[model samples]
Target chain A: MIELCKVTAAYQEQSILENCSLQVSSGEHIALMGASGVGKTTFLKLIAGILPPISGTVHVSAERISYLFQEPRLLPWLTAAENVNLVLSDSEKTIDEAHHWLEVVGLAGAMGKYPDALSGGMRQRVSLARALAYGGDLFLMDEPMAALDDTLISQLLSLLHQYTQGKTMIFVTHSLEQAKIISDKIYLIKNKTLELL
Target chain B: MNRRWLKQVLAMLFWLGLWWGMAVAVQRPILLPSPAAVFLRLTDFIGQPDFWVIVSSSIWHIMLGILCAVILGSILAVLTAQFPLLDLMLSPLLTTVKSTPVASFILLVLVWIGRDSVPSIISGLMVLPVVWSNISTGIRNVDAQLIEMAALYRLRPYVMLRRLYFPSVMPYFLSALKISIGIGWKAGIAAEVLTVPANTIGKMIYESKLYLETTDLFAWTLVVVCISLFIEKIIIAALGRLDIQHGRKVAASDD
Candidate 1:
């Protein structure tokens, strides 16, 4: 579902990922582990088509993609349900779909709350719900549950595992435990390239 | 709230007492009328049917100018933000308008249009640059991450505008509106006074000055201030309601 061939990504003139190559087959779940500022996000952005490689190629077969940014990035003016609904088709059913996804993420009581009124963890959950409600064939998440408690993270991981059954996912995380629970395979960024572990 | 109101009342009374003392010291109503004399003149003017006509006519002209400025300024800001070439082209013209004195514009506009239209044109000119500058900055300052998220979701253009752009720019837009309204009113009244348009508060002020009716001049000036404050209150209240509708907390004083 995703392929990269000698992709070299850089910011300005500094190379973050030099000649990095990776491939994931359909319905594959992969976890990317890396230190801060080590180009894990750079890799995801390349696949999500947000950033272009300075060298080589990247191919993503999925038509629809759902990306959870490192930040919640919720519109301050929109309620939790509305933020989720923002990614969905504008229909009455989508409203219920947004509410349901928020409930699934344990934000049932916060469906009507604005981003300012929400805590950091609550906001991240809303962001997660928005990504889930988008219903994309491929998901690119960058430490989406970093703000949550361990129990909530486990519950959310279980929910995510059930939800993304037939979908391709590449998640970035710093926690080895989370990585082991979430991915079929684990890859770490070592010296500006992916190393399987 | 009541304590605050009482404090404000006391402050106002202090100023009035000082003004009365100064009027007595001057001993010339023509130079500085007492507050009571001005208030009595205002009451007399209010009883006249022409008073409402004059007030309404001035309000209509100034309000028309403000409305036009708001519409055109927003359109120009959006277009210029979208097209850098347009921004480049209009930059000098807006700068010229901003820098030039209001009196110069009033005279220039009077030469081009009728005296009655001069106030509106000058008012619109005074307000346009402020609105354009603030809104364009607002557009530029919208959170990039939010914009990226919107794009990744492939949100429709109108949805992006209505949901993302509108809310982000609203605070800046409201700030511009608040500021420009005061400028528009001041510039419009100054234009009217200079041009002496028919059936306006400016015309009455001018006539009172011509006949040395200082009390009438004070009363007319008071009317202008009152009307300006009233209009500003209405606009702010309306914008506060809009903020509420968008689920934003409305600050008591956005300024």
Candidate 2:
């Protein structure tokens, strides 16, 4: 579903990912982990076709991909329900599905609230709801539940497990338990390249 | 609300009383007519058909000017935001328009385009810069992340503009409209006074000054102020149809 062949990426003149290469087959789920400022983000950006590699190439075969950025990245002007609805293609069914997703993510009461009105954990949950509502063939999540407490994580882990089935997911996360639960393969960004673990 | 109205009434009465006292002190109608005389003149003119004709003509011209300026300003702002070359070339011209006096524009345009086009052209000139600068800033200030999201989602360009750009730019555009309306009125009237259009509020005021009728001059000036306020209210109400009406008073307190 995705391939990066010796892809070197950078911001300005400084190289962040040097000769980084990875491949994920169809229906493959993977977790990418690394130390702070180790270019885990650049790897995702390359796969998602957001950043151009300074050298080599990137290939993504998935036509529909849902990406949950490290930040919630909700349109602050839009209500939580509206933010969820943004990614839904069918306008006629969007409202009901948005409300349903928000409810599933434990944000039923806060659907009308704006991102600024929600707490950090609630905002992340709303973002998760948006990604779920998108219903894409592939998912690229950057620490999808980093803001939630252990209790909330455990509660919502079922929701994640349910929706992520039969699709490729490349999730960047810190928690080993989270990586283990969701990923079929784990890789670490070691010395500017993906290393299988 | 009642207390606020009372405070406003008292403030108005204080000024009106002071004007009456000054009129009495002067005791010369030609030099300084009493407020009563000006009010009488105002009522007399309101009864005349010519007054309405003149007022309506001025209103039509100014409205056309404002409308044209808004359309052209929005187009220019979009182009300038999209192309660096356009921004570089157009910046100095707008700066010159902003800095140049209304009288200068009146004289130059009167000579170039004749008196028929003066009021509308001058008014458009006054409004264009304000609208362009404001909308340009609004376009430039859109959140980069939202734009990226829109791109990734493959949102159509027009849809992206409607959903993201319009809502973001509305407050700035509305504010510019408010300021431009005032400038448009002032410059429109100034242009009319210079060019002496056949039927206009400025023509009536100019004639009053020529005939030494101070009461008529003051009455016409008062009429201009009233009309300016009325049109501003009407235009503001019209903006509500654009789905960005609340943007005028929008101050997001989201924390």
User: Which prediction has the highest DockQ against the true structure?
Assistant: 1
Best by lDDT: 1
Worst 10 residues of 2 chain B by lDDT: B244-253
How do the residues B1-255 of candidate 1 rate in per-residue lDDT, one tens digit apiece? 999999999999999999999999999999999999999999998999999999999999998999999999999999999999999999899989999999998998888877989989988999999999999999999999989999999999988988889888998999999998899999999999999999998888889999999999999999999999899889989987886677576232122
The reply for model 2, stretches above 4 Å from the true place, is: B1-34, B244-255
- The lDDT of each candidate is 0.91, 0.86
Error of 2 at B13 (Å): 4.5
The interface root mean square deviation of candidate 1 comes to 5.6
Candidate 1: the clashing residue pairs are none
Residue-wise C-alpha lDDT for candidate 1, range A127-175, written one tens digit per residue = 9998889889999999998899999999999999999999999989999
Model 1: which docking level applies? acceptable
